[model samples]
Target: MDEINSVKIEFLSRSRNESFARTAVACFAAQLDPTLDELGDIKTAVSEAVTNCIVHAYPDSLGRISVKARLFGDSSLEIAVRDWGRGIEDIGAARAPMFTTGGDERSGMGFSIMESFMDKLRVRSKPGRGTTVTMTRRIASRADAR
Candidate 1:
């Protein structure tokens, strides 16, 4: 897809930053003129991706997380959340519904939720390096909705 606009942000992998990341992405996506439901889906997917970085990627200590968002000419938005901490050993298992390494406190539905809400989802990681989750959603133009 041809890129229309893009933004990248880096922040500490703290629980508090999850909301910041979510809102930032939502704001960047505003130019697409998304509906409330579309905005909510983007925010939720961002929250899950950032939360996973804070809770799972760096369980022992704080780490760096990066989020990059891009807009395409087709009105599609792509968001990538990355963490520079411990990476997942099994990407397949992580994406499975109800599979969680977060113990009892987590429901392990983050990936599944992201997949359901976005048009495309991709997860990449190296066991000792880090993990990156990229998701895209297409915003229906106002005319198309009518």
Candidate 2:
């Protein structure tokens, strides 16, 4: 495998940026020869993460979100979504399936969906600072592997 290639993009915390985030990851993963399933999984995970940032991150103030994608030598892709808003107080509870904060129409499944679709998921948050979610997925090489 070759060295990991990466792409980074930053955007405002707006609903319109969700499509941009998904497309960015899809375009980058295409270079790695990811399968259709792999691409779909990446797109879903990216959408969930980006949506969470737009909805939860900065309820009162405006901020920016950053997304980074890195294609590993093993054909696995790692994506990191970050936001500088009110950080998560309890990552453990937030990660629990169907656990969401008050208000909003969210199903509280963003983190869960990300974890289920990706090979690995990591969350880092600091109250009053920000939160960062990192997700990784391995691309299948052959039809039998699918």
Candidate 3:
């Protein structure tokens, strides 16, 4: 991949950091000058990923959550949200809509929403280890608007 730029951030897995993670990703993505809709999509997807780490990962105690983002020469952006916490036992079930081990009121749409908003989504997890969610999207170039 032709990497135009890349950034990596590590922060505490706290509920309050969700917004920080989202906004930071959005700001980094702004280098592409994506459309408003595209920016919204990126923000929403980042929020879901970060919230997952805060809620599901390290539920008993705080841990580190890492976000790595890269902008490619093709104007495609790739973001990876990683957590060193209790990993998912079942990747298939976790990705299903409304399937949440997080209990009721969660809506369980985190993975589904992330998949829908991003062009590509990949999830890797191992029980007793951690999970890393990678998502990629191609920015809508301003030239395309012409």
Candidate 4:
């Protein structure tokens, strides 16, 4: 009863690509007719996830970051940002508010922001393998409830 539409992109783990990654996902999700607020939420969540991959994943070197977005028939979207660089050591602490490994330069609110904006957020990481953050949101604008 439903067909899923998806897009995937792989880019270098550079700080500059953060915006592009989120924007690309936002654009792809537009076909679902998400409201302005929903679109903004998706963009923000995607940005945080991609930024994490770029900032924390490689730390000292360049690596690849992959982002995938899928739109389902139920007016819901799923996004996944994955990094193959240095994995996370402690996911629990990382998800805590203001708990950042980057010191003063980082606010440590990435996961918190992602969790608040999306309907579902799942993060998986291995110390030496990598980390993947998957987020999902249902697009239900007030205008569409009628």
Candidate 5:
């Protein structure tokens, strides 16, 4: 597929930056003319991804998190959230629903929520290295919108 547009942003893995990541991706996805539902899904997925990085990846300290968003000609929006922190030891367990390592405070639905909201979701991680989550959602092209 050919790339239409792309943007990359790097920030500290902080709770506050989760909203920033969501808004930034939403703004970039705006060019695709996604509907309110699509926009909300994108934002929610981004928030979950960023929140996972802040809460799980850098559990004890701040680390670098990078978010890269891309727009494709097919009206599909792709967002990748990456972190340089303690990576998941078992991706299978991490992606499982309701399997949270973050004590009782967390519900462990981050990956599940992202998978539900996006058309496609991919997660990559290595212990002591980092983790990256990539998600894509296709916006329905409305004939009347153009």
Candidate 6:
């Protein structure tokens, strides 16, 4: 896996950008020859991360969201989604299952879903700066693992 083959995308922190993020991840994962299930998981996890940024990161402020995907040369991929908005005050509680800041409608399962679907998950945030979510997953390819 060469550096030139990596994929990256950037979009506004809006609900509409969710589709763009999903497609970008799916297309990149396809090039890596990930299994169908792996692709779906990536798309779902990406969607959750992007959605969280749009819904929580910036309430009324419009900002840009950036996504970068790189093949780890181990039949796995790493994705990072970043936003410049109000960051999570408590990452520990925010990541807890069923813990949402949204009053009633939000399930707060975004991080949980991402953690379950991806092999690894990391989150960094500052109170007033922003949040970045990093996720990685194995491609489920026997040949590529070598």
How do the residues 54-108 of candidate 3 rate in per-residue lDDT, one tens digit apiece?
Answer: 8898888999999999999999999999998999998999999999878885999
Model 3, stretches more than 4 Å misplaced? none
> lDDT per residue, candidate 6, 1-146, as tens digits?
54435777888887888998998889988877877788889999999999998889987878889999888766678899999889999999999999998768788898999999999999999988999999988777757457
- Count of clashes, each model: 0, 0, 0, 0, 0, 0
Lowest lDDT 10-residue stretch of candidate 6: 1-10
- Which portions of model 6 show Cα errors greater than 4 Å? 1-4, 142-146
lDDT, candidate 6, residue 92?
Answer: 99
* Candidate 4 lDDT over residue span 38-141, tens digit each: 89999999989988887888889999999988888888898989999889888899999999988899998989999999999998999889999999898885
lDDT (tens digit, per residue) of candidate 5 on 1-146: 88999999999987999889899999999998888988999999999999999999999999999999999988888899999899999999999999998999999898899999999999999999999999999999977557
C-alpha lDDT values of all predictions: 0.95, 0.89, 0.94, 0.89, 0.92, 0.87
Give the alpha carbon lDDT tens digit for every residue of 5-39 in model 1: 99999999879898899999999999999999999
In terms of TM-score, which candidate is strongest?
Answer: 1
Q: Is candidate 4 or candidate 5 better by lDDT?
A: 5
Better of 3 and 4 by TM-score: 3
Lowest summed lDDT across 10 adjacent residues in model 4 is found at 1-10
Candidate 5's TM-score: 0.96
Tens-place lDDT per residue, model 2, 23-103, is 888999998777788888899999999888888888766689999998878888889999999999999999998899846
Candidate 2 steric clashes: 0
The TM-score of predicted model 3 comes to 0.97
lDDT of 1: 0.95
Ranking by lDDT: 1, 3, 5, 4, 2, 6
Q: What is residue 12's positional error in candidate 6, in angstroms?
A: 0.9
Following a full C-alpha superposition, what root-mean-square deviation does model 3 have from the true structure?
0.8
Provide the TM-score for each candidate, comma-separated: 0.98, 0.92, 0.97, 0.95, 0.96, 0.92
| Candidate scoring better on TM-score of 3 and 6 | 3
